[model samples]
Target: MISHTAAITIYTKTGERREMAEATPYEEQRRRQVEANKRKLEELQLHHLSAAIREAAAAAKPSLVKKRKARVPLDVADAVMEPVRRSGRLANLPDKPVYREKVPDFGMKIRRTYGSVRRDLTNRVYATDDARSYAISKAEDLEQELDSSFPIFIKPMTQSHVTGGFWLGLPIHFCRKYLPKRDEMITLVDEDDDESDTLYLAMKRGLSAGWRGFAVQQKLVDGDCLVFQLIEQTKFKVYITRASSYYESED
Candidate 1:
């Protein structure tokens, strides 16, 4: 009885497995279809053909080397922050030259010519205060004694006119009005009636040449005043007022 029951249990489990298999016909059919396709691929030798194509493509292609990975931005950040380096050749160049201007020397020449009309070693003379005052008074007296019809011009003498540079510059207005426009010989008649010939330079507006002799003979000095009365076109009647101490001494 135990053997029969054990047999019965085995038979029952076999029957349930058979029934489950029969119920899933679609799964069994799909599995059989996949097996049949694999058999067909094997019969056509398609698996071997695919493997040959892969090998042929690999053999035709060039070999590739593995590329190194790119560096991160932070890895080269210090190098980017550093300043640019200068060329080594620039350090050997010479420095640029500086230029300076030379100063002039004029002290010696100025000392020799200062206050000199003729630029000679002779001492320069100026009129005394008393002599200038006396000459002006004497000039007014001489102007009144001259003829009223004739035009008169007065001049006060200086060292350049009477001594060192005997060059006399006449009044510009007088030369423009009464004197000739061209240079000519003019006569100077002193109070003694002695006549002297002098060149009147229209350009210079002064007496030249014969004037030195007239100035010497008149004994004219600095601060002396002279009155010139134009009597004719080229003739002048001259009167002198001396600045001598003799006149003051006499008074």
Candidate 2:
């Protein structure tokens, strides 16, 4: 969690001049929930795997009672679930939620920030680091805008967006005006300031779930959703809301 003063430092460094902002309490609570959920999912997976192995051994004559997981191929664990993701396999395929964790809900509000035992997830992220670097080398403009902006609102994504999936493309601009270096950490924060904000770099490492990835996120209330707006090219805005905004199109 960031102190209010720290939040301001990030802003002033970027070029925001004394604009007061704070992330809401709701944002911080949800962010913590998501993190806790990810950690617990790993624990559950270990238990699930252990139970299965134990059951297999208990069989009177265990001869390949279980098809060896080797058939699943060897994989490195990542922070966000992929491969075995319980949901949203279509949009972010190949890379899927390794484990599907639960976003707990109670009635109309969140029963808890992050839920339990929905699925398992990997602790290590894959391939995304390279992807971010490639994206950054390709687009500099988007980086600058985001760097200067500091904390912008984000729409919490659903299982459909794919696990470990956040944003894609946008215009390129040199970021020296805001970020000291193109690859330097770019901070994204909520104007409300409850400390749910995250610092990220568009190109360098980009943003995703992993030790080196962005930790900032927004968790939705029971009915709310996040919308992705492509600011330019692949640089998009992940906006949060109760539901999608519907405006009549010009006939």
Candidate 3:
């Protein structure tokens, strides 16, 4: 025993339908307020996130510091980069020294005594040693060879000649000469053969006295030799190969 109810239908003439319910003014305003509140919250979150990122970057960044330079000593300033001398080497300098020499004085007197003939006697010397060793040694081979070595018993006379087995002469040719002007020593140099028998004289020292002094000392005016034989007055022959003791000189 239930009864059925039917809804009321309103039909337009052209057959259009109307809404069943409509929105209220309060609902529209509430929806708009909700949307605005959502937008303000999103903006606030973004601003907070940006502020946090800036703070983190500032804390992580490095700070800058100032630097200082090292100092050098003033005493050794000039010694730097200067060239130094090597080992065992010397350097250039000044104030050196110098040197010199000396001289001496001469002492002695030489002169001619006898037995110098016509010959060149410049700057030469002689002695009994000057007599050639071979010539006197080869006496057997020499012409006019005496039976033995003989000395001449000289006689002061008007003429000079050879006597019987005796030879005589004024023998003033055996001495040397000294030139005072040139200060040169003139020595005896023998340049003759047996036919001439020219004598030359030379010596480191000179006659202490003249030939007359020598003749008196050696008794040459009388006779002195290796062999002796008096044939007559001022006429004698003797072997005369002997050292010259009659002549003395200074060293």
Candidate 4:
């Protein structure tokens, strides 16, 4: 025969009740089971998160392609003439009129003669200011008395006594008096216009005569009757021997 023990109950002045039974082994086992289930659920969630991360990485692949861009020459004539076109001063003048030409023999002869003649004629003519005034007066007198149709060349004397360096300052009216027709005015191709057609001929002549940088300075005039400086030095000299040939030429 087994007897079940009953717990004693005590009541204090305050009404409160307390459970006297301790936890059974079954209850403790149930609590441990609940905790274990929660742990397994957390592990499963971690596995799913890792799988999703791997799938996302596989979907995002890198590309291996490149992108490329295309490259044009310049017009030389247009570039060169553009500046001249923009300048208002050259607008009225015909572009073709500025064409280059070969220097004529007559023009070259004048330039070569000018330097030597000035030295010979005016070397001792002016010493003091009074003498220079007198010489100028004489030049004016000669200019006035000379025939209008005569070809005249005038140049300023250099302060230095160089042999062949005379300043060409002849007035244009003086040149026109002799060469009235515009067509009669001669032009020369020189070192300045080496690439032009006229220059090609000039170069051939210069080479045949063993010269370099030869040029012909020609006279020009305006409507105002002003004489232009008719002579200029060329980069090449034909030597006195070659110059003699030029002098003999009729043109």
lDDT on C-alpha atoms for all candidate structures: 0.74, 0.38, 0.33, 0.36
For each candidate in turn, the TM-score is 0.49, 0.23, 0.14, 0.22
**Candidate that would win on lDDT:** 1
Please write out the lDDT profile of model 3 over residues 97-212, one tens digit for every residue. Answer: 33421111223332323322222325222334323232233322322354333332222211111111122323343122211221222221111211111111223222122222
Candidate with maximal TM-score:
1
Residue pair clashes in candidate 1: none
Give stretches of model 4 more than 4 Å off: 1-126, 149-156, 160-167, 172-251
Identify the superior model by lDDT, candidate 3 or candidate 4: 4
Which scores greater on lDDT, model 1 or model 2? 1
lDDT of 4 by residue, 68-148 (tens): 432212565565544458878778877675554445443323224221223343432224444344444544444565454
* Local distance difference test, candidate 1: 0.74
Identify the runs in model 2 with alpha carbons over 4 angstroms from their true place: 1-164, 167-170, 174-177, 197-199, 202-205, 209-217, 220-243, 247-251
Sorted by TM-score (best first), the order is 1, 2, 4, 3
- Clashes counted in candidate 2 amount to 34
Candidate 1 lDDT at 200 equals 76
Question: Against the true structure, candidate 4 has what lDDT?
Answer: 0.36
lDDT ranking of the models: 1, 2, 4, 3
What is candidate 2's lDDT per residue for 152-180, written digit by digit as tens? Answer: 22333333222344332222343323233
- What local lDDT does model 2 show for residue 169? 24
Residue 187's C-alpha lDDT in candidate 1? 85
User: Which has the higher TM-score value, candidate number 3 or candidate number 4?
Assistant: 4
